[model samples]
Target chain A: MIAAGLDPIAQFELHKIQELKLGPIDISFTNSSLMMVFTVALIGLWLLLSTRKAALVPGRAQSIAEMSYEFIADMIRSTAGKDGLRFFPFVFSLFIFILFANLLGMIPFFFTTTSHIIVTFTFAMMVIGLVVVYGVWKNGFGFLKLFWPAGVPAVLKILLVTPLEIISFLSRPISLSVRLWANMFAGHILLKLFAGFMIMMVSAFGVFKGGLAALIPFSLTLALTPLEFLVAFVQAYVFALLTCVYLSDALHPGHH
Target chain B: MTYLFDMFGYGFAAAASAAETVADYKGDQDGGAAFPPFDPTYFPSQIFWLLVTFFVLYFMLSRIFLPRIGSMIEERSNRIADDLDMASRLQLQAEQAQSSYEQELADARAKAHNIGATTRASVEAEIAKDVEAADVEADRQQAGADARIATIRNQALKNIDKVAADVAAEIVEKIGGFTPNTATVKTAVG
Candidate 1:
């Protein structure tokens, strides 16, 4: 059997550190939970320490903190309008959590919390849930106007457009979750796979010829690391951007 | 070519082994073999922990971190705006001061030019008046001197005629040894 270190899938394996059961449910703390807690602590401490001074002329750490704040604020303001600034806390939390989780996962042997479909799906579900709740709260029956777009003939609206809109609306959470999970999941796997290839080549052929052959996969792995970093950041950005877009619908439904 | 085929075969074999390991690992769990991500066994624990941590993060961020960071940003922007306002106001004040300084300089220059022109005109007028008075005094003194000289010359001419008449009467008396008539002598002298 190959060492677990060489197994790409082993990175995702969960081991219970503290086993707890509630009736029939197993709610044990796992590596994924540790990673989540670490992500939260890191975010909290960074923000807290950075703004401890809160000087008008920001220091380096303060500048970084402020830039992140403005980045998310501007994002919401532009996508969701001035009214959407209300969701600043919610969006900010999601962006920072995902961003830190993805970055921390890049470290060797660190569990990637966001790599799990369940975790990403939970965030996606929360986003869509907020949309539905806020939309109904704000617009009431008018929120249904999102499905019934303007300028469509009544026949086509009932037959084609409304159904399509509802289906697309339902698919929002699924797409949002999968897009993030797939990127992190595939990127890490690819990196591991190439690294595995290099090792396999060196072992299969003697170090002399095998190492020469391994160079190809080695270079490929080297190239993919930076690309994975980019993906990590981009996925976080896309998730937050889409969250804003969905929330914008809640803010103003039926107005494209 | 055979070596290349060998490499391909080994790559597939490695993949097959990795898949088998994954299956073995899954089989060790209580439920039937399933993908790790799709494994229902860990779902309840993941959801529970996810809820706990996410809410903790959300509260920490929304209640604490976000507000602190947001206010700092807002305050910094406000400070910048205030500084800009003050700078523009100071610039306006400086511009006003410079214009007023220029105005005062222009006024002083014009005043100096007016003083020079007036002084030149007054001095010229005084010089012209002095020259005219000197000319009139010289003319008056020459006229007075000419009248006195003419008077003195007329007195000397009258005395010379009287003296000539007296000398002729004395010579006649001495040679004739008789006194001539006084009226005749007078008429001769006249």
Candidate 2:
């Protein structure tokens, strides 16, 4: 495909196994699904080894496991407040999954499940739906009252209030899903593009000119790699923060 | 699909407004959701395992670990409070005992001083009585001795006169009749 000039996107095409069938459903394993299983197994093995023996003082692996636990716990406590304790499992799972997926994608052959919109969107939708549904369940129909401002003038209420609330509500999934998916997608593509550029530049322009041309893309890729690393962390934090906010809204839905 | 695009358009508009704040353009890629050839069926088994994992962790922490720690803290606090109270009570008892000891000591000292004074006064009076008795006895002895010495002196004097008179009488008889009554002659010459 690369030789045929089929574009970089096609070079990264994901195809499902059409041959495999499971009962009525065509459930065949894809790269993304395989990555999920691999991530789960890795986490299980890590935790199993880390917590095989309870220690008064933690060893290196145990300390890492403990730190990971405490880190997510602290994140939830700070962002979601005291009520965050109830959602520890969900939030921890999300953090571990995303953190591993992003880090794993940095490896050459590993697929990042988070890089796919469907997966990210599904995760986001579940969290957001939980927020809305649980908010309504907890607060009754008063959850919808979160959209309405209490002190607005009666005349401007319909004009001003409706659109803001709609936009805000709609922006939740867009922002949540897009943030993770876009970052992963962009980072991976940029790396591939730079690699392609290095190959093309070095070949098209001979040693002297190629070396000079190589420096630009080479430096850019170098700069972007660290930036991508930073983006991975930031996306995780933002995703967790959004979950926190949504959960907060569920617990206490309104300012006014 | 069309609704999704309209939603995207609205999102793009919002994104455009936010673009002034910062660049929101991440170049286009084919990362959007596609209908995969694989089944998108939910796994009931996976859901069952997930729930089991959540409940096990929750119960273990809540029932087992947290309760033990809570009780341990309670026990420690109770023990500390009991120790402090016991120490305070013991200190108070010790102070009371010390105070009584000091009071008894002062009382004993006062009683001893009074006893010493009375004993000293009695001893001094007995000594004065003994000295008075001895002075009386000595005066009496001196008077008796004076009297005996006077008597003895008088007797000796008498004997000496008598002998002198007799001698005088003998001498007078020999010489002439001058030896008259010696007593009368001695008396008349004296």
User: Candidate 2 — which residues are off by over 4 angstroms?
Assistant: A1-7, A17-19, A22-25, A149-157, B1-190
Error of 2 at A141 (Å): 1.4
Best by TM-score: 1
Question: What is the fraction of true interface contacts found in candidate 2?
Answer: 0.00
lDDT for each residue of candidate 1 in A1-256, tens digit (9 for 90 to 100): 5554687777887889899998989999999999999999998889888989878888999989989989999999999999999999999989999999999999989999887888999999999999999999999999999999999999999999999999999999997887787777767777888999888888889899999999999999999899778878877888998999999999999886
Query: Candidate 2 versus the native: TM-score?
Result: 0.60
TM-scores, all models, native as reference: 0.77, 0.60
Candidate 2 lDDT, tens digit per residue, A1-21? 143341334323455533345
